[model samples]
Target: MTALLNELHAHYNGAKLDPSSITRHLEDNLLSPESVLKIVVASDSGGEVVGLLAFTFLNSLVDPAPEKRLQCMIKELFVKESFRSAGTGRDLMNWVIAHAKTAGCARMDWHVKATNEAGIRFYRSFGAAPVADRASFRLMLR
Candidate 1:
Protein backbone atom coordinates (compact mmCIF):
# COMPACT_ATOMS: atom_id res chain seq x y z
CA MET A 1 0.00 0.00 0.00
CA THR A 2 1.03 3.63 -0.42
CA ALA A 3 1.46 4.09 3.32
CA LEU A 4 3.86 1.18 3.50
CA LEU A 5 5.79 2.52 0.52
CA ASN A 6 6.07 5.90 2.15
CA GLU A 7 7.32 4.35 5.37
CA LEU A 8 9.82 2.23 3.49
CA HIS A 9 11.07 5.29 1.63
CA ALA A 10 11.66 7.09 4.88
CA HIS A 11 13.30 4.09 6.48
CA TYR A 12 15.59 3.37 3.54
CA ASN A 13 17.31 6.72 3.33
CA GLY A 14 14.87 8.55 1.10
CA ALA A 15 14.43 6.12 -1.76
CA LYS A 16 11.56 7.27 -3.93
CA LEU A 17 8.47 5.25 -4.73
CA ASP A 18 6.43 6.28 -7.72
CA PRO A 19 2.76 5.67 -7.02
CA SER A 20 1.82 5.38 -10.70
CA SER A 21 4.43 2.73 -11.39
CA ILE A 22 3.49 0.81 -8.28
CA THR A 23 -0.17 0.89 -9.29
CA ARG A 24 0.64 -0.40 -12.77
CA HIS A 25 2.80 -3.18 -11.37
CA LEU A 26 0.22 -4.25 -8.84
CA GLU A 27 -2.57 -4.24 -11.42
CA ASP A 28 -0.53 -6.25 -13.89
CA ASN A 29 0.39 -8.86 -11.30
CA LEU A 30 -3.10 -9.13 -9.88
CA LEU A 31 -4.60 -9.58 -13.36
CA SER A 32 -2.12 -12.23 -14.50
CA PRO A 33 -3.20 -15.81 -13.93
CA GLU A 34 0.39 -17.00 -13.75
CA SER A 35 1.59 -14.32 -11.39
CA VAL A 36 2.76 -15.66 -8.06
CA LEU A 37 2.23 -12.50 -6.10
CA LYS A 38 -0.19 -12.70 -3.18
CA ILE A 39 -1.51 -9.92 -1.01
CA VAL A 40 -3.45 -9.62 2.25
CA VAL A 41 -4.81 -6.61 4.09
CA ALA A 42 -6.06 -6.04 7.58
CA SER A 43 -8.73 -3.43 7.87
CA ASP A 44 -10.59 -1.66 10.63
CA SER A 45 -14.27 -2.12 11.38
CA GLY A 46 -15.07 0.72 9.02
CA GLY A 47 -13.17 -1.03 6.20
CA GLU A 48 -10.08 1.11 6.16
CA VAL A 49 -6.90 -0.84 5.55
CA VAL A 50 -4.55 -0.68 8.51
CA GLY A 51 -1.96 -3.25 7.53
CA LEU A 52 -0.78 -5.11 4.46
CA LEU A 53 1.38 -8.08 3.58
CA ALA A 54 2.65 -9.01 0.15
CA PHE A 55 4.37 -12.27 -0.69
CA THR A 56 5.08 -14.65 -3.55
CA PHE A 57 5.85 -18.27 -4.16
CA LEU A 58 9.20 -19.11 -5.69
CA ASN A 59 11.12 -22.22 -6.68
CA SER A 60 14.33 -22.83 -4.81
CA LEU A 61 17.04 -24.59 -6.77
CA VAL A 62 18.90 -25.63 -3.67
CA ASP A 63 15.90 -27.26 -2.09
CA PRO A 64 15.64 -30.81 -3.37
CA ALA A 65 12.57 -32.01 -1.46
CA PRO A 66 9.82 -32.90 -3.86
CA GLU A 67 7.01 -31.67 -1.67
CA LYS A 68 8.90 -28.51 -0.84
CA ARG A 69 10.15 -27.34 -4.19
CA LEU A 70 8.28 -24.15 -3.65
CA GLN A 71 9.09 -21.52 -1.03
CA CYS A 72 7.26 -18.44 0.13
CA MET A 73 9.07 -15.10 0.14
CA ILE A 74 7.54 -12.26 2.09
CA LYS A 75 8.13 -9.21 -0.05
CA GLU A 76 6.69 -6.71 2.37
CA LEU A 77 4.98 -6.55 5.74
CA PHE A 78 3.74 -3.31 7.19
CA VAL A 79 1.26 -2.09 9.76
CA LYS A 80 0.23 1.46 10.44
CA GLU A 81 2.25 3.16 13.17
CA SER A 82 -0.91 3.75 15.10
CA PHE A 83 -1.69 0.06 15.01
CA ARG A 84 1.69 -1.21 16.13
CA SER A 85 1.71 -3.54 19.17
CA ALA A 86 -2.00 -4.17 18.68
CA GLY A 87 -1.57 -7.74 17.32
CA THR A 88 -2.30 -6.76 13.72
CA GLY A 89 1.17 -7.79 12.62
CA ARG A 90 1.03 -11.08 14.44
CA ASP A 91 -2.29 -11.88 12.83
CA LEU A 92 -0.95 -11.09 9.38
CA MET A 93 2.11 -13.28 9.89
CA ASN A 94 0.02 -16.12 11.22
CA TRP A 95 -2.12 -15.97 8.11
CA VAL A 96 0.91 -16.04 5.86
CA ILE A 97 2.38 -19.03 7.73
CA ALA A 98 -0.86 -20.94 7.38
CA HIS A 99 -1.08 -20.04 3.70
CA ALA A 100 2.47 -21.25 3.04
CA LYS A 101 1.83 -24.56 4.73
CA THR A 102 -1.33 -25.07 2.72
CA ALA A 103 0.55 -24.20 -0.47
CA GLY A 104 3.26 -26.77 0.36
CA CYS A 105 6.04 -24.29 0.75
CA ALA A 106 9.28 -25.79 2.06
CA ARG A 107 10.21 -22.59 3.82
CA MET A 108 9.29 -18.95 4.28
CA ASP A 109 11.77 -16.14 4.11
CA TRP A 110 11.97 -12.38 4.56
CA HIS A 111 14.51 -9.68 5.27
CA VAL A 112 14.49 -7.07 7.96
CA LYS A 113 16.52 -3.92 7.91
CA ALA A 114 19.45 -4.07 10.30
CA THR A 115 18.28 -0.91 11.99
CA ASN A 116 14.80 -2.26 12.57
CA GLU A 117 15.26 -3.73 16.01
CA ALA A 118 11.58 -4.06 16.69
CA GLY A 119 10.96 -5.87 13.45
CA ILE A 120 13.90 -8.16 14.11
CA ARG A 121 12.65 -8.94 17.57
CA PHE A 122 9.18 -9.64 16.30
CA TYR A 123 10.46 -12.13 13.75
CA ARG A 124 12.75 -13.74 16.25
CA SER A 125 9.83 -14.43 18.53
CA PHE A 126 8.52 -16.75 15.85
CA GLY A 127 11.76 -18.77 16.13
CA ALA A 128 12.94 -17.48 12.77
CA ALA A 129 16.70 -17.49 12.53
CA PRO A 130 18.89 -15.56 10.16
CA VAL A 131 20.78 -17.42 7.45
CA ALA A 132 24.17 -16.13 8.44
CA ASP A 133 25.90 -17.71 5.46
CA ARG A 134 23.85 -15.80 2.95
CA ALA A 135 23.78 -12.17 1.98
CA SER A 136 21.34 -10.27 -0.20
CA PHE A 137 22.35 -8.10 -3.13
CA ARG A 138 20.35 -6.19 -5.68
CA LEU A 139 21.04 -4.49 -8.98
CA MET A 140 18.35 -2.04 -9.99
CA LEU A 141 18.10 -1.75 -13.74
CA ARG A 142 16.33 1.26 -15.10
Candidate 2:
Protein backbone atom coordinates (compact mmCIF):
# COMPACT_ATOMS: atom_id res chain seq x y z
CA MET A 1 0.00 0.00 0.00
CA THR A 2 2.81 2.38 0.83
CA ALA A 3 4.48 1.63 -2.47
CA LEU A 4 1.26 2.32 -4.32
CA LEU A 5 0.82 5.57 -2.43
CA ASN A 6 4.34 6.56 -3.29
CA GLU A 7 3.65 5.85 -6.95
CA LEU A 8 0.53 7.97 -6.81
CA HIS A 9 2.41 10.81 -5.13
CA ALA A 10 5.16 10.70 -7.70
CA HIS A 11 2.66 10.69 -10.56
CA TYR A 12 0.73 13.66 -9.22
CA ASN A 13 2.98 15.87 -7.09
CA GLY A 14 6.49 14.68 -7.93
CA ALA A 15 7.46 15.22 -4.31
CA LYS A 16 8.44 13.22 -1.29
CA LEU A 17 5.54 11.70 0.60
CA ASP A 18 5.38 11.18 4.36
CA PRO A 19 4.21 7.60 4.70
CA SER A 20 3.64 7.94 8.44
CA SER A 21 0.62 10.20 8.04
CA ILE A 22 -0.89 8.00 5.36
CA THR A 23 -0.34 4.88 7.43
CA ARG A 24 -1.88 6.52 10.47
CA HIS A 25 -4.93 7.60 8.51
CA LEU A 26 -5.38 4.16 7.01
CA GLU A 27 -5.01 2.49 10.39
CA ASP A 28 -7.59 4.73 11.96
CA ASN A 29 -10.23 4.38 9.27
CA LEU A 30 -9.77 1.17 7.30
CA LEU A 31 -11.12 -1.32 9.84
CA SER A 32 -13.52 0.97 11.64
CA PRO A 33 -17.12 -0.18 11.21
CA GLU A 34 -18.44 3.38 11.65
CA SER A 35 -16.11 4.80 9.06
CA VAL A 36 -17.45 5.54 5.62
CA LEU A 37 -14.13 4.88 3.89
CA LYS A 38 -13.36 1.53 2.29
CA ILE A 39 -10.42 0.04 0.43
CA VAL A 40 -10.33 -2.85 -2.02
CA VAL A 41 -7.08 -4.39 -3.17
CA ALA A 42 -5.97 -6.66 -5.97
CA SER A 43 -3.22 -9.12 -5.25
CA ASP A 44 -0.94 -11.21 -7.40
CA SER A 45 -0.47 -14.97 -7.10
CA GLY A 46 2.22 -14.31 -4.52
CA GLY A 47 -0.27 -12.35 -2.42
CA GLU A 48 1.38 -9.06 -3.21
CA VAL A 49 -0.96 -6.11 -3.54
CA VAL A 50 -0.60 -4.66 -7.02
CA GLY A 51 -3.62 -2.42 -7.17
CA LEU A 52 -6.08 -0.66 -4.86
CA LEU A 53 -9.28 1.34 -4.96
CA ALA A 54 -10.31 3.54 -2.07
CA PHE A 55 -13.77 5.03 -1.85
CA THR A 56 -16.20 6.68 0.58
CA PHE A 57 -19.89 7.35 0.77
CA LEU A 58 -21.09 10.90 0.77
CA ASN A 59 -24.50 12.55 0.92
CA SER A 60 -25.49 14.08 -2.39
CA LEU A 61 -26.16 17.78 -2.08
CA VAL A 62 -27.84 18.04 -5.50
CA ASP A 63 -30.78 15.87 -4.58
CA PRO A 64 -33.80 17.77 -3.47
CA ALA A 65 -35.63 14.80 -1.96
CA PRO A 66 -36.25 14.60 1.74
CA GLU A 67 -34.38 11.36 2.13
CA LYS A 68 -30.63 11.63 1.97
CA ARG A 69 -29.14 10.28 -1.24
CA LEU A 70 -25.83 8.56 -0.83
CA GLN A 71 -23.15 8.55 -3.49
CA CYS A 72 -19.76 6.93 -3.68
CA MET A 73 -16.66 8.99 -4.31
CA ILE A 74 -13.61 7.12 -5.53
CA LYS A 75 -10.75 8.74 -3.62
CA GLU A 76 -8.06 6.75 -5.31
CA LEU A 77 -7.67 4.09 -7.98
CA PHE A 78 -4.23 2.87 -8.88
CA VAL A 79 -2.46 -0.14 -10.31
CA LYS A 80 1.28 -0.67 -10.44
CA GLU A 81 2.70 0.48 -13.75
CA SER A 82 4.05 -2.98 -14.49
CA PHE A 83 0.57 -4.42 -13.98
CA ARG A 84 -1.14 -2.10 -16.44
CA SER A 85 -2.94 -3.45 -19.56
CA ALA A 86 -3.45 -6.78 -17.81
CA GLY A 87 -7.05 -6.26 -16.63
CA THR A 88 -6.00 -5.40 -13.08
CA GLY A 89 -7.49 -1.92 -13.26
CA ARG A 90 -10.70 -3.24 -14.75
CA ASP A 91 -11.05 -5.80 -11.98
CA LEU A 92 -10.47 -3.19 -9.32
CA MET A 93 -13.07 -0.88 -10.86
CA ASN A 94 -15.62 -3.69 -11.21
CA TRP A 95 -15.10 -4.56 -7.58
CA VAL A 96 -15.77 -0.97 -6.59
CA ILE A 97 -18.90 -0.90 -8.74
CA ALA A 98 -20.27 -4.01 -7.09
CA HIS A 99 -19.43 -2.70 -3.64
CA ALA A 100 -21.09 0.61 -4.39
CA LYS A 101 -24.23 -1.15 -5.54
CA THR A 102 -24.35 -3.18 -2.34
CA ALA A 103 -23.85 -0.02 -0.32
CA GLY A 104 -26.94 1.58 -1.99
CA CYS A 105 -24.96 4.33 -3.63
CA ALA A 106 -27.02 6.27 -6.15
CA ARG A 107 -23.91 7.18 -8.16
CA MET A 108 -20.14 7.06 -8.18
CA ASP A 109 -17.74 9.87 -8.99
CA TRP A 110 -14.02 10.35 -9.40
CA HIS A 111 -11.52 12.78 -10.80
CA VAL A 112 -8.83 12.13 -13.35
CA LYS A 113 -5.89 14.40 -14.06
CA ALA A 114 -6.15 16.09 -17.45
CA THR A 115 -2.71 14.93 -18.51
CA ASN A 116 -3.60 11.25 -18.01
CA GLU A 117 -4.78 10.24 -21.48
CA ALA A 118 -4.61 6.52 -20.82
CA GLY A 119 -6.55 6.89 -17.63
CA ILE A 120 -9.25 8.84 -19.45
CA ARG A 121 -9.45 6.17 -22.12
CA PHE A 122 -9.70 3.43 -19.51
CA TYR A 123 -12.61 5.23 -17.83
CA ARG A 124 -14.30 5.83 -21.17
CA SER A 125 -14.12 2.12 -21.92
CA PHE A 126 -16.20 1.62 -18.79
CA GLY A 127 -18.90 3.88 -20.37
CA ALA A 128 -18.03 6.81 -18.15
CA ALA A 129 -18.50 10.20 -19.70
CA PRO A 130 -16.98 13.38 -18.39
CA VAL A 131 -19.24 16.09 -17.07
CA ALA A 132 -19.45 18.96 -19.52
CA ASP A 133 -18.81 22.51 -18.33
CA ARG A 134 -17.99 21.27 -14.87
CA ALA A 135 -14.76 22.30 -13.16
CA SER A 136 -13.16 21.12 -9.98
CA PHE A 137 -11.74 23.49 -7.38
CA ARG A 138 -9.81 22.84 -4.23
CA LEU A 139 -8.95 25.02 -1.25
CA MET A 140 -5.95 23.82 0.70
CA LEU A 141 -6.33 24.35 4.40
CA ARG A 142 -3.08 24.81 6.22
- What would the per-residue lDDT of candidate 1 be over residues 26-140, giving only the tens digit for each residue? 5676536777767898988877678888899899888778797999999989887888899999999999999999989989999888788999999999889889998888899
The residue-by-residue lDDT of candidate 2 on 1-142, one tens digit each, is: 7667677678678885788866765667665777776889898998878999988888877895534488889988989889999999999999898888887777789999888999999999988889898888999998
> Using TM-score as the measure, which candidate wins?
2
lDDT of 2 at 33: 79
Each model's TM-score? Answer: 0.81, 0.82
Measured with C-alpha atoms, the lDDT of residue 10 in candidate 2 is 82
Error of 1 at 23 (Å): 4.2
State how far residue 91 of model 2 sits from its true place (Å).
0.3
Q: Candidate 1 regions off by >4 Å?
A: 1-25, 29-34
Q: How big is the positional error of residue 3 in model 1, measured in Å on the Cα after superposition?
A: 5.3
Q: For model 1, how many clashes?
A: 0
